[model samples]
Target chain A: MGHNGKMIRKKDLTFLQKSYIPEILKGMRQTIAEMFKPKFTFRYPEERFRPNPSFRGRPVLVQENEVERCVACGLCSRVCPALAIEVQASETELEKERYPIKFEINMVRCIFCGFCEEVCPEEAIVMSNEYELVFSSQEEALFGKDRLLKSAEELKPRLEFLRLNR
Target chain B: MQSLLLISALKFVAFVAVVLLTVIMLVYAERRVSAFIQNRLGPNRVGPWGLLQAIVDVVKLLLKEDVVPRNAYKPVHDLAPIISIAVALSTFAIIPFGNTINVYGHEVKLMIADVNVGILYLLSITSLGVYGVTLAGWSSNNKYSLLGGLRSSAQMISYELSMGLSIIGVLMVSGTLRLDQIVLQQTKYLWGWMPAWNFLLQPVAFITFVVAAFAETNRLPFDLPEAEPELVGGYHTEYSGLKFGLFFLAEYANMITAGAVITTLFLGGWHLPFAENLGLSPLMLSLLQVLTFCVKMFFVMMFFIVVRWTIPRFRYDQLMNIGWKLMLPLTLVNVLVTGLVLLLIQ
Candidate 1:
């Protein structure tokens, strides 16, 4: 446009486009039509979202036959990017021989990255579907085995999903 | 004289109450409409379909801290929003909501004030609305606010000319300055079929006037004054709590005034098509006429809200170009043609 009033535009707008009123009316028509269409919003309190099996929510230790599948190898703690998991190994009479006696996952620091679940040698830790993790204090957010462990039957879909994919 | 005073007081109370309520409702409608356009549900939790959201929002604003900048000129900052809301509300005084209605054997005009020079009052008062924005910007000692104030004043000046010229065509067609008389003139049927609305009679004037109205109201496609990306809330950058709430109410109030003005001038104010021939009583007809006026204003207000979300803000240069180059000349031509046509018809 700087070439001494010579036109540099590749395409010239039509009279209607230059006037812009018709184009504006057209846009208004589109918007008004869109108003009658369905809205994509969840009424959060009354309605809830159900995530898929592939969805990684909160991380929990898988429990099999009333015992945790974790071998207390500290691989999940080592792999946790947020440093949310803490594990203390103690010899047990069970066949797994070693289990986490002081197993805790800080809900506040857990970023839901699923890295800890991926790094576990024994499919012991897996992301669960229970995503509504509300904590009043930092101490309250440090989830112990009581809160972090889920039964194998309860997490069957995610386990099945892991089996099918991996 | 006592009865006259009583009726006037009643009308004043009713008008102010309706305007304020409509302002709150307009805010809710804007949010809901914008959400609908974008495929999202907005503010449905406040009340049934979020009907009470705007009222709740006003309460929230009232409860918030009224903050003032340490270096700010405090007096003008306080007075600016008052000026804005006052100007926005006062323009409605001359707008005739309906024809004269008989109440207890007394003829009561449905307007707050029946000023003879209604159009002039409207033009002068609406232009003064810029002072509120300008003073708010200037008093804040914020550069963005200052720029916003400057842009709004310039924008108002440029568009106000076209807005006035567009109305001149309507004035020539109707040949009266009293808004009620103008509305009365529009009640006639042209060629015994078409209702002689100013819009139908002078199409060009209607288009130019509506566009000018959009710009004057500081809505989108001309909201360069408060362009959020560039000016950060524009003149209201420093205002918070109830102070900011007043500006918000003023914006929506200005919108309703514009809608009412547009309806009164161009849309055949309160002249419901063929409603007179329905064998209704005069009192019933007057009531219907009032309702008709409200429905027309509501539709126009809807147009304003929909247009806001439909169009993007104009650049400062583009705004100036349109104001000076396009709308000004267009309205001038429309005025000339209207005058010539009137002369020929006479």
Candidate 2:
């Protein structure tokens, strides 16, 4: 549609008139201007810059007292495009409650989509800012409940310190 | 045979050292330049300003498992990158880096070798580099790699014609293919005011040369060979480890070679502006000229990096069409016009 509307008259320059002389001048002028213009480079190492605030990183599981916030809704397992997340729900000891008995996330398969976080009704799963989670083996990346729970425990002191200071 | 063997061995060691050091530093420079352009700090952890980062990366790659895809041709997969790196390094032979210096008892030129047909040698060797890339892509048995190889070969062949033609104009004006002679020609001022560089007399040729050089080097805007979005990993999609590193080294070496050629041809190879007419001493002038050449080369290298960040890649068809249909015809016209002007003025 856009192509049909525009009727542009193109100047037909001859062999010499069109090609040689004009392109030479245009290119030179462009390069000369560029030489003087402020260079678009940042000296790294000595200087550093921050990443965007909302940058999505690795996913983390949240803890509420002794229990997890996840009621094992199974929304994440259904919505995950990569099929990386696994959650199995079973009736818990608490009143009329269900929770994930077997929850495993394969980091290798996970695309960091944040869909899992969005699908969690209890807000049990959240993506943390710690993006540097590389495992040497595939087995290590298959994060089970124990690892997630351990991470939550590790983050407790820092979270509380921030909360109290604020 | 023994003496020849000794000389060859010495030359090989020197050449290997230079190529490795230059590639490492060039990688660091590229990182720093890109970082500065993007307004971000680049590498800094391994050593001061991350000077040792390339080494660390090399070690990491060495330990990495060299993975060849199951369907890939083993022979071509291994041969491609080695050929790429070898051809790129071979061009360094004929480039005269610095003037002769007196050793303990003998005179030595800093350059490794000075072939009389240095320009032709460089062009031919550089042309062979395309074969490595093309073969790598073709033999990979991957669709994307094959497409990339095809695009690279076509683009390179098209631009190669123009690049050679553009330089013919410079060769005509200087009346010599010897790089040293060309630089000498540009040392004198025209009417004691203008620098007697080819850039002034044959500016048309210079532009064509620079643009075509960019294409030949597979730089941005013309970097259709490894257009990441469409070609995925391009010709080296199936390559990994040191094989991949060799390709990376070859690229930087090509950049250096292009910069050196441009300096030698248009910007007065290692010759200071108005050096001949100026009252400076011979030694002082030589030193100044070398420094000038280095500065010019540095600026050209910076231009390569800056342009890479600024411009978007050209479509495959657009790249080919521009090279063959536009640059080729224009360069031919440039030669004709330059010849006419020289004849008329005479």
Candidate 3:
């Protein structure tokens, strides 16, 4: 006979299995064993998960030499599906001629899709590992330029991961 | 007469308080056990190891707004939860937790009522519990509630027959409907080693009764009435706040009652092996016996929780088939065989 596609066969149950008691006992045994197994739950606020380089948390503007790398191209704002990011560009004397006078990301509106980071031409806005975002009021959730800026040293691992992977 | 009344009233108050406390603990245990079974730590935030979680839950429930549906039958809606809770609490009156204890130079029976027809009273009161569910469903005036109510009543009625019949084997052997007497009868041993509990003597009846108890309590494998996927909260769909809390408390209370009844009937209630030979004082012995009963009931409650997490819910048709075809016939056979064996021995 010629070999065809993989044929899956259902294993036949013996008298004990057919009776349901054995299977039920086996399941109960498994569950009781699982009860003693080590749990994977993190205490959350008190305990935090350290995300790897590829992990996309809040999008942040990389600050190198106490100056933001962003030229305020407005690419991130255009690519943001949620329209959460808003950038107002102004003239600057630095090598990057244009700088954001006001750059704000609405944390509540952000879906954390990493589109802003992916579309940033300057590699300025990159996803950091800081996932803890708590806001009691609407105004508090709006991340201004001061809140959005991160020291390049802090986001080195993510930048390295991006460089290596991309 | 005055003393008797006072004692009875005191017993009632004590029993109610104890039952409410047990219900709270049982809720906590259910969450913890279920979490453990699923490989998760449950509710360890409220107090040390989440001991105060139940209290927090009670507070939350109390603080919630009591929402009644606009088109609901207001009287029945209000009455249903009260009726459910009342029936659940009332059934505990007949369960003998321990033998008599001497308190203040007077002998007091551990149970609230030592009624001769204890088991019969239990069966009748449990049957009345169906009314609460049915009324809740009907009064909600929702299709899901109505269906849930109908399913619950049907399931209860079907399982109650087997549950009642299964006990006939035990009743015949023990020769009494009094729960305390049944426990007393279970104190004997067979072949000088094995305890002659009804569970060992009539295994078939025991299995049937346990299954029936699960169905009666609306636990998993028999929780068709409140099938969350299909019924969307089932009969208590329209219930909110304290009314929903009553239903929740009533369910746990019923579970505790089931555990107590099972302990009284099949397990040796308050009877520890070789305890009589221990030579302890009468007060100490009675206390130990009460402790033994509580331990047995606690294990039963744990078994209920474990089995709930272990098994999947049965489909409606499968539930009916098992109740009527499988459990009913097996119980009948058990009764017949028990009667035959008794006759032969005589």
Over A1-166, each residue of candidate 2 has an lDDT whose tens digit, in order, gives 1357865343544565454445445554565455555544445445443333354566777776778777888898899999988999999888539988988999999998888876777667766655667799999999998876534564554345434543
Estimate, for each residue in B249-300, the C-alpha lDDT of model 2 and write its tens digit: 8998888888888887888777765555689775666677667877888888
lDDT of 1 by residue, B107-133 (tens): 999998989888999999999999999
Q: List the residue pairs that clash in candidate 2.
A: A40-B37, A41-B36, A41-B37, A42-B35, A42-B36, A42-B37, A44-B41, A44-B42
lDDT of 2 at B298: 85
Residue A111 in model 3: lDDT: 95
Candidate 1 residue pairs that clash = none
CAPRI quality of model 1: medium
* Per-model CA lDDT versus the true structure: 0.93, 0.78, 0.92
Q: How many pairs collide in each candidate, listed in order? A: 0, 8, 0
Instruction: Fill in the DockQ of model 1.
Output: 0.78
Q: Any runs in candidate 3 off by more than 4 Å, and if so which?
A: A1-15, A71-78, A86-102, A119-122, A135-141
Docking class of 3: medium
Candidate 3 local distance difference test against the native = 0.92
Error of 3 at B161 (Å): 0.6
